[model samples]
Target chain A: MNGNGKKKRIGVFVCHCGVNIAGVVDVERVAKALEGYSGVSFSTHYIYMCSEPGQNMILETIREEKLDSIIVAACSPTLHEKTFQSVIELAGLNPYQVEIANIREQDSWVHSDKEKATLKAIKIVKSMVEKVLQNESLEPIRVGVTRRALVIGAGISGIQSALDIADHGYEVLLVEKNPSIGGHMIQLSETFPTLDCSQCIMTPKMVEASRHPNIRILTYHEVESISGYVGNFKVKIRKKPRFVDPDKCTMCADCEDVCPQIVSDEFNMGLSFRKAIYLPFPQAVPGTYTLDIENCLGLLPIRCGKCKEVCEPDAINYDDQETVFEEEVGAVVVSTGYDLYDLNHLGEFGGEKYEDVINGLEFERILSASGPTGGEVRRPSDGKVPKNVVFIQCCGSRDPENHNPYCSKICCMYTSKHAMLYKHHVPDGNATVFYIDVRTGGKNFEEFYQRTIDEDQVLYVRGKVSKVYKEGDKIIVWGVDTLTGRKIEMEADLVVLAMSMVQTDGVNELLKKLRISSDANGWLSEAHPKLRPVESLNAGFYLAGCAHGPKDIPETVSQASAAVAKVGDLFAQEQLLHEPTVVPVDEDLCSGCGICVTICPYSARELDKEKGVVKVNEVLCEGCGACAAACPSGAAQQRNQTDDQIFSMVRAILRG
Target chain B: MRIRNREKPFGIEKPVTARGQIVIIEDRCKGCGFCIEYCPNDVLRLSDKYNSKGYHPPYVAHEEECVDCGFCQMNCPDFAIFSVEVESGEREPAPAESVKR
Candidate 1:
């Protein structure tokens, strides 16, 4: 009860939601039914409860009715809970006294029978009225900040976020599951619209992050576990062992010369070979050589020690073990990047059988000056220059029954870039592109596509490729040209499949450890797609780059910088305020069985051995109600949502 | 809570063997061949028949000679094959077709 309570006065407001609710539910009937409710002193109905006049009506009623609490029967609380709360607070009343019953989404929109739906709306409103009478006006709790940030997946997005946060004078930890800091961006020859060299633009940023005073980079490391929330979080990282010691060895070629083990080079998209003890590339950040223990034959039981035997500095450690460590930070930015469409899933395109068929990234490697063929448009089957090359767009995209249904936004522009680059390499070669639709939705991108068609003399055919096979040192592509209404078959020297981008493997497990929810399509969920696009639903966590979905370089960088701005906003506050709805322990009812201690995910509840009871860390509790649900003796009860209040609410709803 | 105990079953027909066996889900194989390359006992080889994905899945050529060093299980990039250890004195060996589905 309130301080000077003489029978608490409550008001109930019903909304039509502009035919969204009134089309099915009778809002006038709902307000009339609640007019004589037990605690309700006033009842009214409005056309739009979220508009300016509707809010003014609520504010004036709170003053005239002397109401201590108000229940708004409107749409879902996720839309208008804060709006009504602010209206009451503006009228010199407590914000917690406003209860919103979601009648539109939960009752009216889902049902067709108007008679039953209006009764259901009345029941839902009555339950809210019962719950509001028992609520207490509580203040938010204030906690201190840790003033540090962690960025996962040292890709282009991660690098940008780390640089932005470090420039804001806060310490940052950058963790990557690769040997180098640069992501897939460094593997490309050039970007679209501007035709700028990818490595030339990426190398400077990698060097700057490595030399930054406030940034600490941990390559070949992955997040193992995460704890706490918002301003205070603890993270555990697992570091894979690199057999060569970084401090003792120089970036030299002596180790690679002596290593006998050979493996496909991932940096070149497996188009080339490298020794087991080689660097990812020459311009790799940190400029250190890493020995892959998985492919190296010298690690287990010491079968071969050729690299260690020839090392002048004795830097090789065959006894290296994987290490696990921890770090504490106030905020997190996820930028795990993406993977190319698996060639295993594209077997129809002969990506696995024929050597001439390649993906977009592999074509990038071939066009690079440092790539396998040294910037020559030679077919992978043999080192012969191709006379005609075919580009197939949307290989595994926009096919709902078999593959991803969404369009890979970058394919059309990148395919245009590929055709122009191939034309520049082989002047007499003909370039044909089979596309579903030419989607150029970025700045200057449509103009770039037109320039490529006019200057490069590239053939654009609107169609889909049905099958691709190898025949007599040439690749045969069978497709249908929708514009001409005819089936067409052609022979080409090389075939490049513009495959779709997919989420990186094993990132779902990391998200589960952090308790973040992913969408049905497997991308990370944003707080709100329009209002709060950079934030994760959880407080103090942020999303960036392709981790949210597929996007281009400029959009990914903008999101990364925006995520850093949110983290900077967090660090600006001296003490952060948290929800005061945490659970409290009842010493009289606790059995000291330690069940609540083991069930809380936040580690908020602990058993007191001396007192034979359980104690709660009020600030750490998030009011998830796990401890209350698992308690055997009813010791852990929520602040506002209690068993007595819930029983009364059930009675009120059941009365109808 | 009440605790319950059960009586052990007797007179079961089974082979008494100490060797381990490996099972393969043919459709899941991408034919990376990392398993066949890493097998310490030379127990596996690439199959001639193609799975639904048109990639050659591996088969156990020397099943009787498998020591189950687990090198293939640990090294398979596609996770298409796994090894099951046999207890010293129980259980019947499952047929290859029985495990494929």
Candidate 2:
């Protein structure tokens, strides 16, 4: 089916992959079995088909046998599909003409019997050969790249990724669903190990990012929808109303002074109160105030406009409405970060009922210099400095029966830090940390953890707290120290729980809008666990920071930088070349019933009203074959995964 | 179908023209001394004077021995200090008499 009217010559290469495949499956017999296949003009086995000599042998055989197509029966396509595809391309064949049969993971590794594994390998190879015979020589898809990137979340991760992309000389649109751009880092008193003041380092970067020429900060905005493919993506963002104009506001705090409505401040983790119309924090970037319309008296029915009356700049606009706009970007970096697991179900812990008991972040706010207690480390009940404090680790984490099965990675270290901070402020304070095991794997993290025990004289109890109840004025904690085998009773003034972390709110809706998938726990799924950590399965989309999983600041920053590097590499090319193995529409067979249009998750298929047929957007189709499977007329067929090609492969495999 | 960079591009390599000196913004330093601890070369030490935040900021203890590794800058969560490579002429020569010490 090439230019010449001659029978296509195809070669099948089977790789031993060392003991990986050769240990169980008979590779030699699998190659010999493919020799009788009609399209397989050449068949051979190599020790390592991905090595230099193995590739040379393939190149020599292809040239000698005049083969136009190749079938690589080897490991999973995720591992070697690109390798063999490039090898075929180097041998003057279209890359699409190279088909990969995943015999290692699908056949050999999964099956126990050698005879059956070899037979299954032969069938997979034969199926790939049939699929390759039907493959048309395809040109790489070339589409113009927008040369711009979108970064969601204004946390340290999003900020770092945006700064990296902007430094690479490309435009970046950083969107945050908050009033300010600091994310959760700004709420911390200090970073662990180094003990450097968090705001002293974070604020400058936030200021620099707001002033960056290539970076546009869109605070108080959420991504509404995402469309198009890798090289070019069309995104719609809904910018919520921020009554105070950022440009006109001077951050004078006059609006906050006059506003009578007091609400629980989210920045301080509800450890303090802020006026209904106020800035999130003193060092909030853009230095702008946002009106919490839900709680503000000035919004609903216009009850009180005292702040508007006192404002000299008249920055407050009561007529502000949510505005939606679109942006074209070449890539997207997701760093939406995480939220703490709610401890409402744990009645024994008293986290929900007790006023003195708080989570780690709430404790962080209580120790913050700008917090309500002014860094006093006081009990929330009576605003008095507590003499005794208890810090519990792995609350609702790593407990399969009660809570999340996975360890919230930061709890061990942060709980130690909280105890240390409490000891630092409350010099003579009795601080006890109850933990299952102390996990300190980061650089110098173990040293920081040890210092809390030896240097600070903090007590470490290897146990789980069974119950916490208020007995008179003191809170009594009951638990058994597993190491000492002693049932202990401790009465503490305050208790801090290191709660588990989960995906932030509204992330599921965002995932649906982006068409990206998540794991069983709702964490974003990476393309591969080790090979491709930052990239999602959907091309042009990247993940950074805790959005993927629980990670520390250093790990989050490194991953953010990696995500930007991917975006920069994609932006480096003016036109991106995608794999041409996408779906093609058959106008003659299409029923114009709009089934394919509805079935396509990528929005690639559309019903043409004029032609009475379903049209395919070649660039958008990812070749998932979902539309093909759902198509009643069999018109929505993938390029190489057609019904005839698939039927022949099935028949050939079953007959073998 | 093959195209390569035909002309020289700009800003490819950040010009290391600050002659390998660590600049400490005194006010920003929270006295964590991470720069001193993580510095590969023994170029920095805690200063005797306290900053506005009541923390001892770090200072260049051995300027001549510095190699501009930037470990101090990277490790400093406070963004209090950073290393910059400067032009050779812009840097002052160490005293010839004290060079032996």
Model 2 interface DockQ: 0.01
Global lDDT scores for all candidate models: 0.84, 0.83
Off by over 4 Å in 1: A1-6, A11-67, A90-92, A101-126, A309-314, A583-587, A590-633, A654-656, B1-101
TM-score of 2: 0.82
lDDT of 1 by residue, A1-656 (tens): 44456567999999999999998999999999999788888999999989999999999999988888899999988788989988999999888888899999998889999999999999999998888888888788888899999999888999999999999999999999898999988989999989999999999999999999999999988889888878898899998988778778787778776554445567877666566788899998767789876665534532446577778889888878899998999999999998877766876786567777888988998888878777776776566888999999998889878989878789999999999999999888999999999999999999999988999999999999999987898889999999999999999988999988888888888898787778866789999989999999888899999988889899999999999999999999999987787889999999899998999987888889999999998888889999888888888888778777789899999998
TM-score of chain B of each: 0.66, 0.66
Worst 10 residues of 1 chain A by lDDT: A295-304
Write one digit per residue (lDDT tens) for candidate 2, span B37-81: 766446899989998988899989887655454667777898889
Q: Model 2 segments beyond 4 Å from truth?
A: A1-4, A14-40, A73-78, A101-131, A650-656, B1-101
Estimate, for each residue in A79-170, the C-alpha lDDT of model 2 and write its tens digit: 88888888888999888888888889998788889888888888889878877777788788889989999999989999999999999999
